[model samples]
Every structure is written in C-alpha cells, then in structure tokens.
Target: MEFVITGDGSNTLYHPEIGEHYHSKHGALQESRHVFLDMGLHHFLAKEETNEVSVLEVGFGTGLNFLLTADDATRRSLQLHYCGIEAYPLPTDVIFATGYHRFVQPATWAAFMQNYAQALTTEVDFAEHIRLKIAHEKLMDFQTDDQFDVLYFDAFAAIHQPEMWSDQSLAHICSYLKPGGIFVTYAITGNLKRSMKALGFTVEKAPGAPGKREMLRATKVG
Candidate 1:
C-alpha cells in the first residue's frame, strides 16, 4: 500500500498501509460519509436553499466530500459553488489507491474523479450550475472575498493537526460566513467549542456517528 491505514482493516475502508490518516476503526471514508455527508450535509441542505449553496471546506483531503456533494447537487438538480482549501494534496495514484471506486460506480466514479482531477489544475465550471475553485495552499494563507452559506471544517483531528483547529484560524473562517450560516465538523473539543462561541457562533452538540462521542454544528448568528 502507498499510504498506511490505521485501525482494523475490516472496519477501515482504505488500506492501512496506504492511507495517511484514520478517523475511527471504520476508516476515513466511513467517518466522512457518516459524520459530514450523511449527518452534516444532509442536515444543512434540508433547512437551506440548494438552488445555489456556497460551500467552504477546509482540509479538502481526498476530495471525497466534494465528490459526494457534487453528486448530491447533480441529483438534486441544484446549483453548487464549491470552494476548498488544502495544504498538502495527495497524488491521484494515492487517491485511487484508496479504492474509492469500490463505493462509487465505475462510470460514475470515473466522471466524478475526472472532475476532481480537473479541479486541481484549473478553476472551471464542471456543469452549468456547478463550479469548483480550489486553492492549492495552506488554510492559514487562504483569504476569500466571498461569503458561504455552509462551511465544512474537515481538518485533521485536533491531536494530529492542532494548528488547523486553532481559534484564530476558525475566527478567520467565520469572517466570510453569511448570517445564520452553518459550520460543521467532527470535532467537539471543549476548547474548540469555547473558541467558536467566542467567535460569535451558537454552538450545538449533535449525535456523532459510531465510535465518536459528539460532533459540532454551529451557526453564525447575527
């Protein structure tokens, strides 16, 4: 395996030897789909307008979230304006090595992967209503003039990527949110919650997926 995967191989989807990170024994994809996509994304879309939803995702990771979101948007026939940031990008070979195809169909997965791949080298429109712009830079240096209705803070776990979870960085992200905008993440640390509250977010602890205690979903209230 190109990357090392941790936790039990059965529970974890990616090859432990090939994956660079792990959220639970169930694997990173399981964690992301369950926590962020199913719980967070589904929740956000339920109460908001999807004709055009602006999204900001930190730690783009393997772009699984983006792909899922894109597919959802296409399925829903909604417009999507996605902006994501990442410091270190994994190679396409590495990403494919994770066996994403096993979940997504071959044809559909190929189209999805192509869009994701094209996103890296260009900021272009995938479809009439779908546009993707990625910043191949560290989150700290990323500054956007646009406001987002939803933010997916998918940085590494606090223990591994402490800098990405700092109050200052979160505050910076909050500056670009529309009033009542929502921010979701798998982290629910005490300090992180306090920091979010300090930044003017009304925080709520939601039911976390298996193997996790709680996840955070906060909204920026005017």
Candidate 2:
C-alpha cells in the first residue's frame, strides 16, 4: 500500500493488490463526510427521533467514517454504537499513519488510536457516548441481532470485488437493516438501484462527491 495525497489534501491508501485506492482520490475526508456522515447518518438523525443510533459499516478500511460520526455524535450528546466488518483488518501502524487524525477531534482520534486494537477483539466504550466493535471476519459470517438505523456500504468497487456487490450479498446485508433505516454508498449504478429495490429499499439518486456524478442514498422500505 502506498500513501497518496488526494485532491483535497487528504491521505488515502492505494492498494496494489486490489488496484484501488481505499478512498476517493478526489478527496478522502470529503467523500466520507458527504456520502456517509451527511447523507447517511445525518439524514437519518433528522428524520428519526432517537437518543441512540446504530451504524454498521462494511469495509472499515481506515475508520474515517466512524471517527467523523463519533465526533459528530459526541458534540450532540447523542449515543452512537458502531460496528465495522473487515475481512482483512489493517495493521495498527497503517491506521496510525493515515494522517486521518488531523481531520477528527483530537480526543476522538486519541481514543480511536488507543482502543482500535481492542475494538477488533471486543466492543469498547472509547468515549462517553461512543461505542465501537470491529468484526474481524468476512461480511457473510457476521451475525448480529442488532438491526442498524444506518448502514455505510463502503466495500470496494464491484468491478474489483463483484461478489461483494452481488444480489445475494446485497440481500444478506440489507436484511440487517431495520425498516425505514438509511443505506448510503458513494457509487450508484443501474444494477445497484435494481438490487436495492428488489430488497425493499426506496432508493434515490443523491449528488455524489467530487469525483462522481451521483451516489445512492436509499431508505429501507417495509
């Protein structure tokens, strides 16, 4: 993996094996804030009246989404519980080297850096209102009774990891979302919209981040 400075002056890792960057080259921080935090979490929070929110993130490569969401929740005094599923978790050093700390609150960055490894083994309350757990397993093997209010589908592009975007995979993942839940991703395609509709989500086309034309912001339909 090589560190590349994005157009927005943020750092994102380029994976030689996958032939993909962990985040958008247009901007790492911008993409996370636009697609996940703003479109996914914030939209849900505004529509639903709740003191606590549950978020499930796929990929979970650099934990940028989680950090931003946690920081946002802390400021609002909202309780947030997040779960990230990663088939191959990054090393502690790689995470520390991402230079992502410059974007999040210092306290949040410190807590995440200190408890990241522990979160891989078990859920940890790293801050007064933030709890995180990283499932060190493939997405299919993940089992949880908890149905999330927001789902950040941050997997690699379907071109590189087709199986992760297959109809069956989409169904299995969406099954974990409660009715009226939010599901957001940085990519939008005809196949994706069809799959989300078939799986009972009211999908919409949202404005994309800097590099793309559009994104998918879907709400689970009963």
Candidate 3:
C-alpha cells in the first residue's frame, strides 16, 4: 500500500495489487465530504425525524469517512451509530502517514486517533454523539440485524472489485437499510444505476465531487 496525495491535498492509499486508490485521485476529502457526508449522512439527517442516525460504510480504508462523519455528527448534535466494514485494515503507520489528522481540529483529531487505536478490537466512542464499530470483515460476510438510515458505498470501482458492485451484492446490502434510507457513492456507472433501480431504489445522479462528471445517490423506497 502506497500513500499518495490526492488532488485536494488529502492522502489516499494506492493498492498496487488491485491497481486502485482508496479514494478518488481528484481529492480524498472532497470525495468523502461530497458523496458520503453531504449526500449520504446530511441528506438522511435532514429528512429523518430521529435525533439518532445509523450509518453503515462499505469500505473503511483510512477511516476518513468515519472521522468526517463523527465531526459532523458532533457539530450537528446528532447521535450517530456508525458501523464500518473493512476486509483489510490499513496499518497505523500508513494511516498516520496520510496526515488526515492535520486537517481537523486538534481535539477532534486526538479523539479520532484514540478511538482508531482500538477500532478493530472494540466499538469506540469518539465523542458523546459518535459511536463507531469497526468490523474487520468482508462486506459479503458481515452479518447485522441492525438497519441503517444511511449507507456509504465507498468501495473500489466496479472495474477493480466487480463483485462489490454486482447486482447480487448490492441487493444484499440494500437489505440492511431501512425503508427510505439514503445511499451514496462516488461510482456513477450506468449498470450500477440500473442495478439500484431493479432493487427498488429511486436513484439520482448527483454532481460529482471533483475531477469527475457525476456521482450517485439512491433511496430505498420500500
């Protein structure tokens, strides 16, 4: 795994074996804030009546998404139960090398790193509003009866990890969402949109984060 700086000055890991970056080369922070934070979490919070929100993230590569969501949840005063599934967790060295902590307030970063140290071992309460549970397991093998109000599908591109973007896999993941739950991702492929539709999601093509044309947001319509 190589740490490479993205266009937005944020770092992302490049897996040479898979030939995929953990985030958009355009901007890791930009992509996460746009697709996951803005489109997924905020969108869910806006429409949902509950003070607490449940979120499941497909790829927890560098914990960027979780950290960003935790920050937002704290600021919004919304309780967030965040579950992140990652088959291969990055080493602490790689995570530190990314310099993600430099981007946030010192207090927030400190809390994030403290929880991150025990991320794979147990659920960590980064803040009163943010409780994170990291599962070191493949998404396909993950089992949970808890349903989510938001799903951040930040997996590698369908081309690199086709199984992750397959109709069967998407359908399976969608089963974990509550009705009217929001789903967001950086991938905006035609086949993916169709697959979401076939699975009963009302899909929308949202403006991409950067260095891309568009992204996708879908809602489970029941």
How many clashes does each candidate structure show, in the order listed?
8, 0, 0
lDDT of 3 by residue, 1-222 (tens): 788889989898899999999988889899889889888888887787778999999989898998888777777788889999899888877776788886676777888767776978788877877888888988889888899999999888888899999888898888999999999998788899999999999999998898878889999997
Can you tell me which runs of candidate 3 are displaced by over 4 Å? Answer: none
TM-score of candidate 1 relative to the true fold: 0.85
Local distance difference test values of all predictions, in order: 0.74, 0.93, 0.87
> lDDT score of model 3?
0.87
TM-score of 3: 0.95
Please list the residue runs of candidate 1 whose C-alpha ends up more than 4 Å from where it truly belongs after superposition.
1-22, 105-108
Global fold similarity of model 2 (TM-score):
0.98
My TM-score estimates for the predictions, one after another, are: 0.85, 0.98, 0.95
Q: Which stretches in model 2 have alpha-carbon errors above 4 Å?
A: none
RMSD for each of the candidates:
3.2, 0.7, 1.3
lDDT at 156, model 3: 87
Tell me the tens digit of each residue's lDDT in model 1 across 77-173: 7788888887667677666666556665455467656676677766768667788877778877887779988888887677666787888788887
- Tens digit per residue, CA lDDT, model 2, 64-111: 889999999988899998999999999999999999889888999999
